[model samples]
Target chain A: MKFSPLLDELIRELQVLPGIGPKSAQRMAFFLLERERPRGQRLAKVLDRAMSEIGHCQHCRTFTEQDLCEICANPKRAAVRQLCVVETPADLAALEQTHLYSGRYFVLMGHLSPLDGIGPAELGLDRLAQRLDEEQLEELILATNPTIEGEATAFYIANLARERGVKVTRIAHGVPVGGELELVDGTTLSHSLSGRRPLE
Target chain B: MKFSPLLDELIRELQVLPGIGPKSAQRMAFFLLERERPRGQRLAKVLDRAMSEIGHCQHCRTFTEQDLCEICANPKRAAVRQLCVVETPADLAALEQTHLYSGRYFVLMGHLSPLDGIGPAELGLDRLAQRLDEEQLEELILATNPTIEGEATAFYIANLARERGVKVTRIAHGVPVGGELELVDGTTLSHSLSGRRPLE
Candidate 1:
């Protein structure tokens, strides 16, 4: 049987999500159909509602219901003077998994890519710089990926923080060549942290 | 900050989806967090709603909001006198994309794999056999994949159909080795249709 156009549209939207290629999208679409009507309606409603309600945390740019994310609102986290900078909220989450950094985070959303036309302004570099100054951050940890674009973004942010006399650091090389921090095993991540050297 | 236990639960659930390994699941979880609170609620609602509303078509295992799926409900489809059997609803969708098959479909939802505890009973073979006896099936197309399990399933189904004194045919070898029907290019699929030969 042919999928209804609405069903196809939903599948297409799901396909846009990373790793959800055509087949997976079709499976998910069919799975949704197999779900109870209330379940599908609830999911669709929440999808629309979350898209409308979930906004960035003003303090750290992480997703949160309130102006500040849980980390930014917590007094316990405020005690830590470190700030980990990442290209996306997902990256911040990866670092958070380590339990090594009790500090705050700044999600840049994207890296510097001249070819793709992504630049400092587009990535909210000014907002990040302002936060660095306003928060009186002790350490600005650049945890962008190790790719060329990521490295470029890291250096740019590092320079911005360095100019303000705030110490800047990058997550270490425990991440393999062409490796993404999101995929690295926990032990390797810890070793990378322990072996971190100052960015020259 | 570590995700709350509830968020962790949701992320784990999301991870169970195919191709959504740990990192991608984490990304989806965080992305949803920024955007999921209500969206998640909606998803749950939709899941419950759709599951309750949809069920297996009485004639075919394809999901349908109504008692009979669109295909089974349509009189025109019943006139085709052919039956296309697939490993799953996704495979049925691949066949639908070809726009060549006018017959109805019977989704097995899985291939035969004795090693994996999958057998005729698990794949609803009895229902298919009943349908073959009931309908004036001109052709039973074994449109399953070319994988070991898929082949086994096809052979098993074909033998059953032949024993019932019904004609049986397998999809052409136009599908690449180890390639899923969903991944086959449209041109190759159409070519495969025209090149189909009688199965021994």
Candidate 2:
């Protein structure tokens, strides 16, 4: 009933990847088996090592093999005393691309979702509080997404920062660059209006 | 500039999978590192095995770990003495799903394309010819795709079978069942008209 047992198992296992369905998985398997066996073997080795060896940075919780990530270990970044809290390492990467801020980051890994049982403790707020207390942070920048859950997580963290006399600020919400005014959502337009800044 | 050296290598190597670009590769790498490391490790092992172990069936040229695939090894399938020539193992699987063919198959793996330097030898036509010479085949069915290259391959193989005195036939081309006639293409419509059969 099956074509090849190993090929079938490979296809099934490949579906663990996001957005890859059975058809795509089959294509990938066939491509690897037919055209790129050596490359596929290399991928296997790297993928296995990445999965088994990579762990969270002790300081920032971003993925890293080392105890402290590069950003966390940098003394100059630490001297800035400006900590940007983001929901994931992907968000940290996005911010780093802009070259706008020279501060360190704390990755929460996920946002608060009570319905899904994700809460403050799950987001590592205790670890964040420890950083705030020990580092005497100048400011805590909230770069969580603008979703309802993201907003709730940001608000919760803001209260925690307030209790410790740490000033908290959120990334600005507005129309995205190159986006049309009419295409912008109502909530985003309202936030843009309320959070307006003076012209330079 | 990079997140982690190992993570970067993993993401780059993952791009060898078809349709996985930089963004999807990053997401896949992070998803494995974050949520599914155990499953990812298992996938790596299976993928490595599939890439390294799977080889073409000696008789049919279909993908299999063994020299003779399950279909080729079965005596009843060989007893049918019918051989279907297909462009790929995927096509064989598709035909099997219809449950209309109980015979064995020969997979070309790819159609002829002179521009790409693939010819009869690359397609293992010599191996196919050996089967024609030795098997005393009752019938040879051309089920290659309906493309120009598929047509040329079918024609070439038909001559080969004719010279060997094996009955040669082709799968028909027509409007697909359950498809709208108005939406059918001109070439397929013409083929349908020329290949028409009388109503039962």
> Which pairs of residues have clashing backbones in candidate 2?
none
Candidate 2's displacement at residue A75, Å, is 1.9
Stretches > 4 Å off in candidate 1: A4-10, A30-53, A66-70, A73-77, A80-85, A94-103, A108-200, B1-10, B29-50, B111-126, B144-165, B169-200
Model 2 TM-score on a 0 to 1 scale: 0.98
CAPRI class of candidate 2: high
Against the true structure, candidate 2 has what lDDT? Answer: 0.93
Worst 10 residues of 1 chain B by lDDT: B1-10
Model 2 residue runs over 4 Å out of place are none
Cα deviation of B13, candidate 1, in Å: 3.0
lDDT of 1 at A45: 49
Computed on C-alphas against the true complex, the DockQ of each candidate is 0.18, 0.84
The DockQ assigned to candidate 2 is 0.84
RMSD of each: 8.1, 1.1
Worst 10 residues of 1 chain A by lDDT: A34-43
